[model samples]
Target: MSKRCFLIEASNQEATEGQIMTVVQSSASHPLYGDIVTIVGKNRVNDNPVIISAYSKDSCHLEAERPGIVVMPNSVEEVQKIVRLCSSTKTPIMPAGGRNGICGACLPRVTNAVMLDMINMNGIVNLDEDVMTITVEAGMRWAELIHRLDDKGYKLGFRGPYGGNAATVAGSVSINSMGYAASRFGPAPEGVVSLEVVLPNGEIVRTGSGWNPEAQIFTRYSSFADLTGIFLGDHGTLGVKTKVTFKIYPKAEFSTYIDLGYKNLKDATAAFLEIQKRGLTEELNCLLARESADTYFPGLLDSHPEINATIHCVIMETDKQLAERKVQIIRDIGLDLKGKDLGNFAAQIHWAEKFNEVQPMYNNGFWLNTCHLRPISRIPELMDRMRAIFKKYSLEKNGIKWIADALAVDRAYAAAWVTIFAPTKDKMELAEKAWNEMLDAAMETGGCPYWSGLLWEKRALEKVNDTFIQLYRTIKKSIDP
Candidate 1:
C-alpha cells in the first residue's frame, strides 16, 4: 500500500489514501490478521490484483475504487477467516471477480477497504449425476466451467456475459447476468439452486438444501422459506459469496439464427415485443440505429443501408422441423410489423463470432457500453431517450450506438445498451456523460438499469421506495454488524 494522497471535502466518502496507507500497514496487528496472511500468503494478499491495477488510469474506465489491501483466499475456510478478520477490524471488504464487470460493483466505495479477490477460491466441489447439479466455488470462470461440464456431457441453461473468459460464476449470480442461451433458460437467477455466503460479520450461512443434512444439495425449497434469493443480485452488500450450486442441462439439440430488418425503430421494437411474448428464441439480440451498426460493426450499415434495425435471433429446438416452425412464427410477426427478412446468414455469422465481433474494437479503439432492463413495450421510448442523450452531448461523432436484447425469461425485456468508443482522454469524458444521461433516461422511462453497481446507486435511491430502502438498511445492519 503506497502513501498516495486522496483529497476529500467535509461530506461523504471515507478514508484518504494517506489513511489507507497507514491503516493497512498496521493491519498485521489485528487478532486474526497474522493467521490469514500466513494461510493466504502475503504475496497474493497485500497488493492490488493485476486485473484491476489499471483501475487508477482515468482512460482505462475500470472505475475501481481505491483499495487498501487485497486478500486472495484459496478455500472456504480461508475466506471465512479473512471475513472474520475484516469484521473484527471494522474494515469494509469488497469482493472482485475477474474484474470484467462494467458497473463498478467490485470497487470499494468506502475508502481503505479490503479487496477480496476470489480467483484463488475457485474449486469444483461436487457433481451430482442423479440430481443433475454441480457445486462449485465462487471464483470459477464461465469458460472453464463450461468446458468442464461439456467434457462430462452436461451444460448449464444460463451462462456468463460475452466476456465469459474472465467472468466469474458467483459474480454472474450476484449481478443477475444475461448472455448466450439466455432465451432458453433465463438469466443467472433462474439456474441458481443454492449459495454458501459469508455474511459481513463473518458468519457462514448455507441457503437451500444445504440446511438439511439428510437431503443436502437435493432441493432449494424449504418448509419455511427459500433464502437463496436474498444473495442473488445483492452486489455484495449483504455478504461475500463463497460457493454456488446450479442444475445442469443436456446440450441443445438444434440452434440457428433468424435475421429481421426493420425499416425503422417503431416496427423493429414491435417485432421484438412479439418475439418476446412467444419466448421461443435461444438467444435474441438486435443492432438497432444505423449509427450503431456503422460505428461498431463498420461496413455493416453500408451493406444494409436500408435497414433501420437488424435483429439477429438464435432459434433452438429438439428437431429441425420444430426449430423451422418457430422461425416462421417470428418471421411472420416481423413481416406483419412491416419488417424485411434480412436472412439468417448474417446473424449466423455474428452468432458464430459472438465473443470477438468487435464492440470494443471500433475505429478509434476500446469502447464502453451501458444498459438498462425494461419491459419490451417501453423499449421505443428508452431508445429515443438514448438518442436524445447522444445528441445533447454532441457524441454521435464519438461513434455512439445502441441496441436491445430480449431476456430469455418470460415477460422480460432489456433495452440492450448504448455504446461509444472514446480512444482519447477528452472524448472519453464526453462518452461518460452520455452514459450517465442514458441511465437517467432509463429511469425517466420507468425502467431500472441492469446492474445496481455504485454508478446507479444514486438513481436507484431516487426511485426506490423509502420503506424498501429502510428494510434493506436494517437487514444490512443486522447481518453485517
Candidate 2:
C-alpha cells in the first residue's frame, strides 16, 4: 500500500513529533468544502486526508467512517451559519471538542458528514466574581479554565476530568464527566449554571436562568423546567454547546493528601465509602485489587505484598483547622477499617500530574476500558465477578493485563473504571470479547455509565428502561427533528 506521513495536530494546537502518523493519500476535495470555507474562512477549514484521519476516531481503539470535510468555527455566528448550511443541504454534522474522549463520542457516523472542530471557538466570555460564575466558550480547555480561575482566586466546584490538559469544559460537561472534585460536587453538570446551545435546526437556545432574557446566568435550577439538563450528558446528540456558565468557588486556602493501604478490597472499599459519606475529601480514588494497585503504583507494594488494595484521598478547605480535622477523620476511618497509612506519595503524584499520568499507562498496552458508576458497597462483588471473567478468558495466562479500580463520586456511588489491557494486536479480539462480557456483568450489577458515545451506547441502550429511552427519544426528536 502507498503510504503518506502527516503530522496530526494536537487538539488544534501545534503538531508534535510523536503525533506523526502514516496514512494514505493527500487532500481530497469535498463538494461542501467551498461552502464551509466561506463560512469559517479558508484557513480554518480543511478537506485534507490528515485532518480527516485525525478526526476519524477519538482516544478509543475503534474508528468511525471518515468525515468528508472538517470545519473550524471560531464563533457562535459561524457555528450557526455552518449548521444552517448543513441543515439546508441535508448533510450530517458532528460537533467535536478536544477529541480527548476515550470513547468514540466525537466521530461522525457517516462518511459524508461535516466535522465541526470547535477548538477555534475557545474564549472566556465572562467572569463574574459578583455571582461567582464564569461564562466561557464551550471549546475552552479545563486546564486553561482552572489556571485562569486560580489567578483570579476562584475555582470550579468540579474542576475537570483527569485528561483536563486536553479535555474541554463543554466536552466534559456534555458527557457528564466525573473527576477532580467530583467526590464533593458530583459530576461536571452539577456545577453548570447555564448553557447556550445551537440546536440541530440552527436555532439558539439558552437554558437555566438564561431562559429569561433579563436574568443573570447564575443558577441551573431556576426558570421553568431546568432545560439545561437536556444537553448535559447527551453526548452531542441534541445540539452543539456554544457557551457554558459554571458556578465557581473561592480557592481553598489549605489542602492535604493521604494514602491508606488495606489488606483486602472489602476493608478498602468500606473506608472509601465512609470517607465519601463524611465528605472528608475533595477527591477520592481506590484501587480495588492487587493487580490494579500494581498497575498504577508498580513496585510500591513490593515491600508490603500483603496489602491488596489502596485508597488515595485529597482534602481541601478554606480553613486549615477544618482541613486538618477532615484529614484526621479520614485517617481514623481507614484505621478503624484495618488500613495502614501508606503516606501521601500516590495522592500527591495523582494531584500534581493529573493529565500526564494516564498516558504513560498506554505503554503497557491498549486499554479496553469499561468505565461506569456503581454503588461503593458492591465493589467487592464486582471485583470477584471481574476476576472470574478474567480467569474464564485466561487473561493472565495469555499475557493480558487488567485493572479494577474505582473513584468516589458524589456521596454514595463510585465510578468503577474496569479496564483490560490488550498487550499486542493479536490479543485485541480476545480483549474485546472479554470487555463486552465485563460490560454485561457490570450492567447486571447496577453499574451505570456516564458517557455512552460509541463505546457504551448500544449496551447502555439495551439495559435502559424502555420508557426512559422513549422519553429521551421523544425529547431528542422534538428538538432535532
RMSD of each: 9.3, 7.2
lDDT of 2 at 275: 88
Which 10 successive residues of model 1 have the least lDDT summed? 11-20
lDDT by residue for model 1 (1-481), tens: 1122111122111222111122233335334445556766554455434423533322236565676666666666667777887887887888878777767778787666777778765667777776777888888888888878878777887766777777799888888787776766777777888899988767788888889756647577777587898889888788889889888876666776778888887788788877877887877776667665554455655666778877778886668898888888888888888988877876677667655554355555445666667776777777778777767877756654444343434446753666566666767777777777776777888777667776577888887888998998887787876
Q: Alpha-carbon error at 417 in model 2, in Å? A: 0.6
Give the per-residue lDDT of model 2 (tens digit) for 1-481: 1122111122223222212212443354787877776775556677777778777888878787888888777678878999999888989888888998998888888878988877766777777766778888888999998988799789899989878889998899899898888899999899998999999888999998887776667688863887998899888888999989999899998989899999989889888998899877888999988888887887878888799999999999999999888888899889988999988888888878877877787887998988899999998888888999999999999888888778899898988988888999999998889988998988888888889888888888777798998999899889877
Model 1 gets an lDDT of 0.70
Clashes of each: 1, 0
Candidate that would win on TM-score: 2
lDDT of all predictions: 0.70, 0.84
Report the error of model 1 at residue 342, Å: 1.5
Model 2 score (lDDT): 0.84
For residue 76, give model 1's deviation from the true position in Å: 0.4
Please identify model 1 stretches exceeding 4 Å from their true place: 1-35, 48-64, 295-303, 362-368, 398-409
